[model samples]
Target: MDSAVLSGRSLSRHFSVKGAAAPVEAVRDVTLEVAPGALTALVGPDGAGKTTLLRMAAGLLAPSGGSLSVLGVDVAARPQEVQDRISYMPQRFGLYEDLSVQENMDLYADLHGVPADVRRERFERLLHMTDLARFTSRPAGKLSGGMKQKLGLACTLVRLPELLLLDEPTVGVDPLSRRELWEIVRQLVEQERLSVIVSTSYMDEAERCQQVFVMHQGRLLAAGAPADLRSRAEGLSFTAVPRTGNSARTLQARLLDARDVVVDAVPEGGHVRFIRRPDASDGAVAQLLDGLPVNPVPARLEDGFMMLLRAAPPPPTLPTLPTSPTLPASPALTPPAASKPARAAGPAGGADSMIEVRDLVRKFGDFTAVASTSFSVARGEIFGLLGPNGAGKTTTFRMLCGLLPASSGFLQVAGVNLRHARAQARAKVGYVSQKFALYGNLTVRENLDFFGGAYGLYGQRLEQRTSQVLEEFQLGGQEHMPSGQLPGGFKQRLAMATGLLHEPEVLFLDEPTSGADPLARREFWRRITTLSEQGVTVVVTTHFMEEAEYCDRIVIQDAGKVLAIGTPREVRKQADDAGNMEDAFIRIVEQNRNGGAP
Candidate 1:
């Protein structure tokens, strides 16, 4: 520990708020160490103190109580010296939008006080490493999400220091971009012998690190190598194939609701992988599975992470289904008997098509954002639209929601012709954009009232609906609080509540769980499953490839073109039975990019 690159002993941070009863303890009695020339990850949910610890190490924020040393210097007493020896890239890396890529790099270099003689070689190497050399003259605003992240990274490296700190570097980017950014960081650690400490929401990303520190509720839950953590769930992980009548999502929801016998559940490869409570007996686990065939699967880092989180009680802020029986049938979520059949190439069962598109196209000046795409969604199906950044998924989503006009093609939603009745179609669908669009200054109820009025509800009807969702989404107690002051999970719940106030037949979600932790994501999907079961069609877009398994069918697009479309299993088969959805997605996109098909 004496040779540690950075270390903290009993680090803690607390903040006082104006109307709060006590100080918000952002970090409490925590201790950790980062090794030199190796990758280390701080894994946690929102409000878990990861950012606070990083800021303390960077000398941007002082710890309330503790001793911290960086590069053998006491950071608390000599902040300037430690600040000069480390590079910190926060969640939002500052970049001038109007500046060219080269100009942005120069700005960082100038700020870092790099010598003129060292600029040329460093800039060239950084740009090439980021694969942004060709776009050096392009304005930063014109870059895609992934490209902008790469540029941000390049700027962060204009002058390499003793250590690197990255906070959720891959949060909003696509799978392809996430992979590329990790490659750049790995090369820096392996070749340049750099010391790194990154905080991330992706469990798979944490698995890539040599050591991981898991934090929750401002405290360190555990810290060790990824393999050592995986061992914690060794005997408790299992995958269950749903019975003939149920979908993987439906079955996963049932398991998740069984809190006494199940700790976590997620859809994967046409099956539901779940973790049984350590104290639950074999009979209890079987009853929760509802007679489905089950088999043991190797425990993943995520399983261990989930198990660690279960030690802490979940926030009672999200809705849950009744726990009466195995996969308890909620009157709101169970599809009717007549339309219960699901098809691989078309809508679920023989249900009527709720969304249809043919030869759809969107053009931005001379560029085609969407090129000749076709698809259909059943009345109660969960359909996923997936693609890399700038692949036109948003353009396609906008057209479906009636927010943007398609350049050419036929479009229909809820039996309303988009071209002729775009306004009417809009009334039948609820839309949640990638970012939270509600007014943060307003209280939860006030924001809901404003959006409800905009949706044409008023008087008693608006009041009734507002109260209904307040209880349904578990936001009743916090109704009078300012929306901005709510926690990350509560904010997301409010967003979804607003979208559902009008009772739209179809719901549109764009990367809804982009940076949410695994626990929050599980709860979010559980609610979505309930909505679909209630005959409301759900159309979603996400960068989490594993989430694609929840969709009845998915369409993958690249370069504004559809590359593949089918159920998760069918899509995997198209990729020659790739191990998982992520692998299948990468294979399909890489094959198409390389002028071939899998």
Candidate 2:
């Protein structure tokens, strides 16, 4: 038998909510094993207890019941022993924001008691491997989202631990960074016989693992290779593209409602793909797709997950809140208009230019986050900025939004120079940050109202705008709930609602759908399309390459440079031999990493 690096028997964790009567079972009766040198994935949705299970395996959290052992040490009884042999990266690992990249590495190395000579060698290799040498002196907090993720990974890798436990390390990281992180893992597993247990929400990432464990509501639903889980979904999947007036969102919702027959439904590009319940008959599936263009297709991991979730009855729905008296019944809320001056022409046809950026640069002392990059965003288009973590997408975004001033370059928003007119440029664009930016203590309605007022809206107009936005974003019923108390999906909707409260000509979303479910993503895109119909130009970044298909055009960046730019179809063509976007992305990034043209 293969060596069991870590094993858990009937492991469970419970947390007591401050006000709740009963303890919340974060993880329940979970049993699993991580074999030496094997890549095992713990997959689940938000709050599904993936983190809890990983923590227990890492000896960071003691299980309320059952037992766990790391290597030969009993974690429950010998946590320090397990800690000495394993590297555990919690969901929010402490990365010193004030320290420079090299300083952070040195600090972690010192903490791990790595010898000075060995630490020097390891740090040098890591800096080169992560391509962070150029930014060695830059503060960790000052780095872009992707850069921070890379730094965090680098800090953990300073010491050669026998086991590595990472809890959603790539949650908000970009594709390039994600690929690099995985490559490092693959190499470590092969070279050192390292045992790794990582929790991730991305199915593609999970598919790369040798073994996958599916968890939901603190229970293990399935465990096997990706192929094995996919095989179980055979003969149940069918694909259908949008026809006539039916949108993907409409089709998905309709299919989801048929829960008894259709086990799962997901939107891939322009089509709705689904899996039928095992007990569902052929005729029943046919009936479900009656009048729609449907074809048999292979099943995917996501399809399998949806099938499993639908097969088992759903957990009880949370109780609804009382209606708010402040919100009026009629007309609803209408978001404030854009604060910036309106452009002479609508997005469809501007003076041949929508956003012109020339020789744009953002630098921090000796470190340059974005090194003289240039790009343009067309009017009435969905433009995507793609790259690995720390690729400078966020830096470029901040400069575009006038949140961060460019060190040098000619930057224009809606044909107006931002350096000369910062407020005007900012007013013309709506930005949804990667992090939750809304007031957590404020109700959804209050958050929207505050944002709208910031844009100079007032009185009944502000109230009307808030109502309209709430309804448009599907948060009409949850208006009174505090934004902080909402789930991942609802929180995303609330943030988006606030961003769009003022009708800006351009919408900027930084990983807006990060940590969101497939269903929520589809819904969010539907709203994006609705806004696009009204001629709102969208500039966004996402870790999910599949979501890139929704964009009219995309730009891939690396090492502070634009690598590729084209329509989704065009970019896929660039992959040529690689086939899909995921494959193309890997190919492009690997070539760039190896010092070739991206």
lDDT of 2 by residue, 1-598 (tens): 2368877789889876432346778898988877778899888765678877877777778889998888878898988888888888876779999999989999999898999989888888778777899999999987876678778888998998888888888878767667777887787788777888888878877888899898877888899998888787888888877675445545765676686787666655556777778887778877887778788898777777666665654553223355643323324122234343332222223365678888998898887888878777766567788887777887898888888888999989887798889898877788898786988888777888888888777898788777776665556566676777666777887788778776787889999988765545655775675565456778898888877766767788877888777765567677664545667777777777888855
Residue 11, model 1, lDDT: 89
Candidates' C-alpha lDDT: 0.86, 0.76
In TM-score terms, candidate 1 sits at 0.93
Best by lDDT: 1
Query: How far out, in Å, is residue 210 in model 1?
Result: 1.2
Alpha-carbon TM-score of each model against the true structure: 0.93, 0.78
Residue 348 of model 1, lDDT score: 49
Q: Which stretches of candidate 2 lie over 4 Å from their true place?
A: 1-10, 16-23, 65-69, 72-78, 97-103, 114-151, 157-159, 237-297, 315-380, 406-419, 441-446, 467-486, 517-520, 559-561, 586-598
